[model samples]
Structures are given as structure tokens and as C-alpha cells.
Target chain A: METNMLPFMRRLQGATCTWLVQIAIRENAENLPCYAPMNIIPVKMPITTPPPDTLRCIPEFVLENVVVLITIARRTVKLNMDDADVVNLLAPALTLVLTFMGDSSRTYNPHLRARLAECLEAMLPNNEDDSSSHNNISSFYREQIFKTHPHRFQLVPCLLDVFVGIEMTGQSVQFEQKFNYRRPMYVVMDFLWGFEEHREAFTSLAREAEANMEAVHPPIFLRFVNLLMNDAIFLLDEALGNMAQIRNLQNAQESAAWTNLSAQEREQNLTNLSHTGMLARFDNILGRDTIRTLVRLTAHAPFVFCHPTLVERIASMLNYFLLHLVGPNKKNFKVKDMKEYEFDPASTVLDICRMYVELGKNERFCAAVSDDGRSYSPKLFTLAESVLVRIRGGDLISSLRDVAARVSTIAEQRQRDEEILANAPEEFLDPIMSTLMLDPVILPSSRTTVDRTTIARHLLSDQSDPFNRSPLSMDQVKSNTELKEKIDAWIAEQRGKIAHTSTSSTS
Target chain B: MAAMSPSERRLQKELMSLMKEPPPGVTVDGDQASQNLTLWTVHMEGVPGTLYEGEKFVLQFKFTNKYPFDSPEVTFIGNNIPVHPHVYSNGHICLSILTDDWSPALSVQSVCLSIVSMLKTTAGQFVLC
Candidate 1:
């Protein structure tokens, strides 16, 4: 078999020669031959190979030799062996291959040919230069390259690898000059669109890539991180939006559910739900970082458009984090050490109660005992009542009354001080008086001595002005008094009816 | 379904009122008459000084059958999403009070406010899992 390497070389030499001749006809065709012999042999041999695998393999060895020779030849001919050599050689080949593949009359598998072309494209200069050509390259990928061979878009990884190589070899300045115009966002957006188009596959790839982050080269790793971070934030926002919608639906449904329950049943149900055990599970899910991302994503969302459940989710996570922070076994711990604490409900409650005492937040103390009217545990109520009574002289009611009295005294003192100040010379009164008077004694006493019965009576009482010296106006006070009296009367009537019924049953 | 008890009715009305006149910078939507009114859909516009600025996000809320007394379940709704470190891609949130240390006194409004503030203060930072 007589092999006609001449015809092969002619064809390989054909395009470059034609392009050079066209330029030469205008300037100098003599320079064309100098560039021709170097590129012709390598490119021609690969094209003439009988097998596709042989053709594909040829570039590995042939490219380097051809590139070096082409570089030397270009310097000899044009006085510069710049990126123009690679661009001129690769671009024309790419254009030719792409155009050929796009032509429907060609019967060969365009997909395979496109894939092969991509492999070759990956070998081209990965410049760091921020140039118009770089932007054009990126846009080309986004518009033509990606569109033609969507599956082969993974070639981005290879392209990125080449860029990393260029960066590592100290050619970054030159590369940047060529490619710097391409924004990171463009590559990121391209990856995102590709990922979205193939979600499951991309997700797996992402996971795999993340798992292998340590093995990746520094520049490629950084690019991957940048891409991942951007995508993660974008997806988080989207996920959060969907979650908000679901939450709103859930809240509306829950309200309807609550309405369907009887008053007693509703109270019982709410009480049961408020139990520490149930809340713990709820917290576990919401307090996870995932919920934070969602909440943070839609925190300022408009109420009508925002998820109603966002608040609930945030509340759940906040409460959970706080519980972990201040709950029993959590004391003497820094925020960093919170996860070390064992989650014990009983201990957590005790810790909370102790904290309330330490902080002198009476409101919180009262809240712990009466979280929900129906679910107030007899044991917890007794314990709280005992603690209150022990501190407040064996009277829960009196303790509240004392707090009320103190509050009133403070208010009156504030009023008196203000009145005196208004009338007095500015220099006469001490400037320190306002601070002293306004400073609330957060810790009123070591403990309260209020019993359960007394606390209940105070709660139920109509005439008992527990928080003495009300803040309301006379008319408002009168109206509140009337309302309280009606409530008290109704309660008394109900009690009397229950007593009568019990007595009749006993008889 | 049986008629609602007065207390339940009051809760329903309160929920309705919240939906109709949600606090400023908050928006909510979902099925109105569904059996699980506890769940809802929400969209939030990004506030200034946050990483989420100029972005819209979604959330899902699933209230326990015991709601108000018990906090609802909230989760993010997307896959492989970008988020601040504070946010988990798994839809978990890291806010305080939703867990064991909850106070019944904290309302839905306050929770949302806290989240908004978190976004404002943290800006580019995120919660770590």
C-alpha cells in the first residue's frame, strides 16, 4: 500500500496556507511557507489515521512538538512567538471542525466529533489575561460551545485545569492579559445553568467534588469553592422561598385545626404540645443550620408574601439555641462549649429557674410555672409555689402583692422626682437622682414565698389590686375593674354551681 | 367538622389578622381553609446590609397540631443551595428559643424581627452548623 503523505500534508497545510496566503497576498506570501511546514506534518498525520482512537492519541505527543516548532517558526517569521500562534492554529481548526459538524449533509456522528474537538479545545492556551478575546471565549462557550454539546460542557473542568496550569507556570500575567476580561460570574453562571439543567447528576458531581477538595490543585480548588459558594447561596435563597410558602400553608391549616378543637380540647392539646419533650424535637429540626439559612434568606420578607412559619421556625431555633446556652448543665460554659452539654429536660428547667433567680427576671419565673393554662404541671406548679412561698413569707399572693407594691412605689417615686425636678433649680438637685430612681432593682428578694393557693387567688381575685397603684387613667381603671368584677362573678357563679352539683351527687 | 370552640376561634381570628396585616417587611401566603393551617409559604425581600440583599428566598412552616403554645416547624425548601454559614442546606435553622428554652410569650412577630436583625448584623457571615 503506497501511503501518500503528500496529499495528507497538503490537506493539513491547506487551511493554514490558505489563511496565510490570503494575508500574504495583501502583505507577503513568502512568510506563509515558514509557518506552514511546522504545523502541516503533525496536524495532517492525525487526520489521516485510520482509527479514531489513533487520531485522538496522536495529539498527546504531536501537540507539544508542533507547538514548540510552531513557536520557533513564528518567532523566525514574525519576530514574535506570542499567543497568536496557538490562537491562529487552534481557532481555525476549531472553526473548521465546528462548521463541518454543524453541516447536516455530513453523515458522521457530530457528537463524537464535537467531543473530540472539545478535547482539543481543552489543550489551547488557558490565559489569565483579561482581554476582549477572553470574554469572547467565555461567551463562545456560553452561547455556541455549551449549546452545541451540553453534555460535554463538563469540559469546563479541563479548561479550568489548563488555566490553573498557566497560572502555576508563571504565565499568569500573559494569561490574564488574554483572559482577564472574563468575569468569574460568567463561569459561575455557566456552571449554575449547567447544574440546573442536570440537577441530579450535578448534585452528585458537586458532592464528589467537595469530597475531593483536598486533592484538587489550589487554583482549581479556589475556583470550585467560589463556584460552590455562589451556587450554595443562590440555591439556599430559592429553597428558603419555597419553604416559606409551605410554612404559610401549614400555619393557615393549623389555625383552622385549632378552631375545630373544643375549647377544653384546644387547651389540653396546646398544653400537651408545650411539653419540653415535644418542643425538643421541633427545635432539633429548626435550630439546625439549614433553618437558619432559610430564615436568614427570607427574614425580612413581607408578611403577606413571607412564610408565616418563618417566625415559628426562627422562634424554634432561637429557643433551642438559648436552651442549649442557659439550660441546666449548660452553666459555666462558653458558647463554643454548648454542644458538650448533655440535653436533660429536668436539668434544663432547673437551670432556667436558677437563671431567672440570678437575673431577677420575675416575668420569666412566672412564665415557667404557667406556660399554658391547661398543661401547668401539678409538680412544677407545686415546686414553683413552694419556692415562691419560701421566699415571700409563705404567701404566693403576698409575694406578687409585694412586687406590685414595689413597682408602685418606684413609679410614685419617679413621678415625685420628676415633679420636684420640674419645679427645682437645675443646679439644686443632684444629676445622679434620675439614674438612682430609674434603676430597677431587678433582684427584689432572694426568693418569693408565694404559695400556689395564694398565687391562684391573686390571679382569680377581682378586688385585689395585686400590682398596686395602676398605671391606667381613672376611667380606664374603672372599666378594667368592671371587667374584672364580671369575670370574678362568673367564676364564683360557676364554682357555686359545681359545689351544688357535687353535694347533690354525694346525697 | 365540629364547630370551633371560642378559644380556637379566637386563635383562628388572630392568625387571620396576622395574615391580613402582617408586620412591615414580612409577607406570607398559603391555603386559607386547609386542614393543616399550621403550614404556610413565605417570601422575604432582602433587607439592606445583609448578604441576602436583592435576593428573594422561600420558607416552609409546619405548625404542630398544638401551635402558638408550641412553635411551628420551619425549613428551607431547595437543594444544594448557596447560603451563609449560619444557614444549613438541609433546612435547619439555628435561632434561639425554638428549642428547649422557648418562652410562650415570644410571638411570631418577634421571631421574624430577630431573623431580619440577624441578616442585618451578620451580613456576609453565616451560622456554622
Candidate 2:
């Protein structure tokens, strides 16, 4: 008879847990005693809200009871994780309380949001001992929370909002109060850092969901891609905006216009310069976090970068940034050399370029980047060459530099197309692709001339002769040396035409 | 627009020449192709006395940035896919120039001419059901 009661007992246990959780969340609930030492809690309430009459206050008793419930749920899940019955019983109650806390962050009770963040931090797995088991608990909760939400991955975005809220407050008189949420954000980041398995699982699920239906915004995975990409771009823009101001001020001081300004105006300009310097410091710290997240995303969740819109945005941003860095009249931010700026402009530039390199390693990503007419390959190759020049070591760099050099050579050959097309004879053109061929080669079987690069790309997917259907290989094709010489001479003659036109126009 | 890619430069030149002097019975939708060099829609008609005479057709060409070197994916599109043994109802064209026999020597004009000739030769071998 006792063995038969086991299933009933499990249901009874779940009902009781649900009742307790509801009681804890009630408006005027009574305080519960701390289960473990207060120190074990990951975050502390550093400041208190004003008197209850002034603002809507969450009853202190309810806050305490909720924290106790959170601690209990976290510990139970961590210890008896292997027991399916135990985990199932606790997950609902915990998810209910966690969802309430998450929703509270956006509510009118502002101070309670901070208090709830402490509870959230406490519930996260952060014990120094048995770190792996703690991580498993967090992972289990991620899946559980996602299962509850209509859109998944709400956890990271929620924590990110809280984190952004804290960062927005900036430095204030109550420094500890303002910074208390950082621990929760850091723990969430750690969870995501070890989130490879979950990432792949959720990513595929999101992709399938997307294929089945259309939504206003992209799937959560792509939203994260947009979020991170936009964050990096926005931060870089802020830094650049400050530098541009600095440039203006420096220019003003150098020019004769400086003497014409009022003393107050000059002083105001100086003050603005100093203020921007301070903001640049803040940007550096913020940028470090953004870069870390980006690096992790590119490392673990690269498929996210495969989205066409996101890839285009990244390519354009990279193009803008690289051009800014290397273009004539480059602005050098003093922050680049300072030890304080962990992610200075120079490092940010390098990281962005390296991110491109990292993502470009995958063939699918390369195909997307190279598919559109607004292709960024030449700019990227130029950047790769510059990066190679700067890093100047490593086997990978040597190999990449070789590829970059080859592309650069092709780019050089194509750069004169407008000039050559104006006067080059028809016979000088390749039998294929019509453009003046750079390295003309004669196909053995077809007895026709084409650019070597053109044929090489063609042979990647097919081996037969384009004209005769003969089995043709790269070795069978020979350089059309006579045609190449004539084409090179035509190219030189076009350059002379350009020079003459420029001189005549200037005169 | 920063500097055009090599393919875009080639496409620019092609677009210019086509607009200047399109082949008989073939006209490019220049405005659409100019907006995006990667995808083009061309308006083609069967030559005057061929089997497809007086019939209008639309051909869609999708070029990768690797154009010229990589042949564009071409197919008959819109409501008027030419009824040919090689043309599928779904706008997929089974032509050798599109796949195996593609060479970089080909241009947009050359492709249009080839498709026109293919339509000219079709005489009731297969029809779209």
C-alpha cells in the first residue's frame, strides 16, 4: 500500500510547494527566517528606499520571504539535480517567483527592483566550491525559464536591461547602491560563457520557428546579433564623436579665429574638451565588456553572424571603421595610449578587424559577405594586409597575407578597367568575362583565351572545357604571354591618357 | 557607394552598353538592375518569326560578387516563362551555360542572346503541365 502511494506523494509535494510560493509573494506576507548564513547570498541590499508613504514600497516582509524562497529553491535544485521529481516540483515555483522578480525590474517600485536583483543574484549559481554543479543548476534554469516564456532567452536580455539601467545611472552619491546589480550581470555573463550546448540547441529551435512563421522582429538569436552589433557600433560612434570635438578644438586653437572668440566661449570650449576626456574613460570600460561579449559570441555562436542583414551591418561598420583608421586625415585619440582605457580605439579597431577575420574563417560567412554587389572583400583584404603589417608574425598571418596579396594584385589589375575600356582593342579582351584580362591563359582543348583567375574560379565547381566539353585541368592551360604583353602595354597607354587629361585640365 | 567591386564595375559597363544599344527584341530593366547589381530582371521577346514570336518573357539574373568568374544564376521568371523543353514551370532553366559549360567570357548580353536562341529553337518538344 505504501509503494502505491509514491505517485500521490509526489503530486502532494508539488501542491505544497506551489502554495508556499504563492504565500511568499502575497502583498502583506510575514517575514521568514534566513535558511543559511546571510553571507551566502550573492548580493546585498546596500541602500534602503525612502519612507513607504513617499513611494510604493514592496512590503519588507514579502521581500524577505521571497529571498528565503529563492535561496531554498536554488539549493534544492543544486543538490538533488539528478532527481527528476525534485527538479520538476521546484522548477514551477521557482520560475513563478523568478518571473515576478524579472517583471518587477520594469515596475513602479524602483528600489524593489534592486532588492529583487539581489534575490536574482542569490538564486544564480555562484558558490566557489563545486562550480561545475552550480553551472548545471543555472543551465537547467535557463531551459526551464525559456520553456515558460513565449520568446526564449528572455533571461539574458532581462539581465542586460538591468545592467544597462545601472550603467545609465552612472556615478552617483550612493555608489554601492548603483553598482549592486553588476554582480548579477557578471554571473549571467559567466552562464552564457559556458552556454555552448544550450546555444546550439536554442539556435536551431529558433531557426525552425522562424522558418515556420514570420515575425516583426527576427528570432531571439538574430535579435541578440543585432543588439551586440549595434552596441559595438554605438560605442565606437560615441568615442569618435568625442575625438571629432577634440579635433575641432585643436583646430580652433591653431587658427587665427581663436583670438576673435569671447573669453567665456574659449573657456567653455576648454571645459567641453575636459568633459569629453572623462566620457572617453567611461566608454573604455564599457567597450571592454562589449568586446568580451562580442569575442565570446563570435567564438561560440558564430552561426548568429550568418544572418544577411547582420552581416551587411557588420561589413559596413568595419568598412567605416577601417577607412576612418587608415584614411588620410586620421584622428588619433589620446585614449589609445592611456593605460586606463582597457578597450581604447586602437584595440577596438584591432578587435573589430580580428572579429571579421574570425568570422570570415567559415565558408558560409564568406559566401554571405561576398555575395552582394556592395561586396567588402577588397576593403577587407586591404584591412587584412594592414593588420598583417601591424601584427607582423604568426603562421596564420603569413597565410592570410598571401591571400590578401593575391586579391590586392587582382584589385590592381581591375582598377584600370574604366581607363582600358575606353581605348583597348576588342582582341585584347578575354574571350570570357569581356574585361581586359590580367593574366590571359589559353585553354588547351578549346583553343580560346580567358583570364587565369576566371578559369580557376570556374574549375572549382566544374572541370570540363566551357566551349568543347573536353576534360581540362589547370596544368593544361598555358599563359597567353603575347596577349598579356599587349594588354599590359595598352594599360600603360591608358595611364598616360589619364595623366595627360589631368595635366591639361589643371592647366 | 564606395568604390565599386570588380564585378560591379563590369556590370556597370555592361549596363551602360545594354542601355545604349540593346540587341533586337531584348531590353534590360535598367532601373531595377542599377538599384542592385547582383540581381537583374531583363525583358526579352521571341525574335519576329521564331516559334516564340510576339511573345513577351521576363528573365531574372542573380549575380554573385564573384560574377564573370562565377556565372549568374539565370532563369525565366514572372508569369511568362517561355515554354521550352529546357524551361521548367518553376522558372528553373536547364541550360549548360548556366551550370557546367559556364565561362567567365560570358556577359549579360551574351546570356540574353543565348536564351533568345534557345527559345527560337524550341518546337513543341515539352510543355509545362
lDDT of 1 by residue, B1-129 (tens): 112322243245445666787765677763542444556665566775666667776666665544444555666665433375555778676776566434323455556666666657654455454
Q: In model 2, where do residues sit more than 4 Å from their true spots?
A: A1-98, A101-187, A194-217, A247-266, A334-337, A340-343, A362-364, A367-380, A387-396, A399-507, B1-129
Best prediction by DockQ: 2
Per-residue accuracy of model 2 over A1-507 as CA lDDT, tens digit each:
555353455455456445433333333223537221223212111112222221133344544455555555455555544334434544443443344344433233445455555655544444454433445555555455444533234445455444444433434315434433454455456554455544555456446534522233234455545555666666666766666666676677768988899999899987986787666656555555666677666755565565433555565666566556544434454333355433355566566656666676655455444433343455555654564466542434555555445544544544445545655687876555565787899999889888876675566456767777788776778999999999898787788877788899999
* The best candidate in terms of lDDT: 2
Residue A247, candidate 2: Cα error in Å is 4.7
**Fraction of native A-B contacts kept, per candidate:** 0.00, 0.32
Off by over 4 Å in 1: A1-483, A486-507, B5-11, B30-35, B79-82, B123-129
lDDT of 1 by residue, A1-507 (tens): 235542343245436433432222232234354432233222321122232222222222322333333334323433322333233344444433332222222213323233333334342322343232333443343334334442343444433333333232343245323223123323333343344343333344444444443231223434433332333333333333333333343353377676886888867654543352233333332223222222222222212111121222222222333333333323322222123222222333333233222222233222222222222222332344344444442433344344334433444443444333343332222121211111111111212222222222222222222233122111121122333344345445555665687799999
- What are the lDDT scores of the predictions, listed in order? 0.37, 0.59
DockQ of each: 0.02, 0.16
